[model samples]
Target: MTVRVLIADDSSLQRSGWRMVLESQPDLEIVGEAGDGARVLAIVRREPTDVVLMDVHMPRVNGLVASERILTDAAVRELGAPPRIVLATALELDDHLAEAARAGVFAVIHKDTDPESLFDIVRAAASAVDGRAD
Candidate 1:
């Protein structure tokens, strides 16, 4: 099954870069895109996507806050398996990193992660979504 993905980043280049990497995998599908954290919720609401690659720094909400909101939302929380989120951060801020764990993130992927690792991370996250992982 294809894992539906949403990309949220302030930079167009970063978004496009991730799209290219993720879409290259036949098992991953690019379902939606957003350039600001302010727009992420709406996109996810409309798309019913299974995964989100969110940037930690953005114009409005930022990835940490967005991830918290998604995890707490009754709609997502009530699901047997909710959309897995892997925040993309330029800097691995310890605060945001710890917060990500508390926010129930499936993973935190670096913005500069190598293509092979990115693919591996996404696949592992999908396994988490399916209750086959920790």
Candidate 2:
């Protein structure tokens, strides 16, 4: 099955880059894209995607806040399960990382993360969605 992906990032360049990288894989699908966290939940709800590759910092709302909203929202909750949430942050592991962890987001991948590491993240997020560890 294709792993449907929703790309949420403020940078147009980074969104394009992420699309190129994730959609290059045969098993992944670019379901939708959002430029800011404000648009995120609405898009996700509209499509009911499988995974969210989210950038932590964005205008209006941020990934961490948006993620929390998505996971706890009644609609997504009633769907039987929430999507896998993987944080793609440029920031280092600080209190935010722990907050994300506590929020039960699947994985936290740095923006400068190597090509090889992306696969590991994708795999882990997929596994987490499959009812495995986050």
Candidate 3:
């Protein structure tokens, strides 16, 4: 099955880069892209996404806040299983790790993570959603 994915980041370049990398994978599908957390929320509410790669800092709402909201919102929950969220940041993740876990984030990775690792992370997150490693 194709894993539907959403890419959320404030930078257009970052979003584009991730899109390019993710699109190259046959099992991964880029459902949408968002420049901010609010857009992420909106898209997930309307689209069926298996994984979300979200940036830590964004205008309007941050990744942690968006993760919390998406995991808890009744409308979102009604859409079936909530998407697994993976928070990515340029800064140290130590401070945000606890809070991100509390918000039901699937994982956290640094912005400099290798492309292969990023692909693995996203696939793992998608697997967690449906109990299928593929």
User: How many pairs in model 1 have backbone atoms within 3 A of each other, for residues 3 or more apart or on separate chains, i.e. clashes?
Assistant: 0
**Global lDDT scores for all candidate models:** 0.81, 0.82, 0.93
Q: What is the TM-score of each candidate against the true structure?
A: 0.88, 0.89, 0.96
Model 1: which residue pairs collide? none
- Which tens-of-lDDT digit does each residue in 44-70 have in candidate 3? 999999999999999999999999999
As a whole number from 0 to 100, the lDDT of residue 7 in candidate 2 is 91
Off by over 4 Å in 1: 75-80, 93-95, 130-134
Which candidate should be chosen as best, given TM-score against the real structure?
A: 3
- Which regions of candidate 3 fall more than 4 Å away from where they truly are? none
TM-score of 1: 0.88
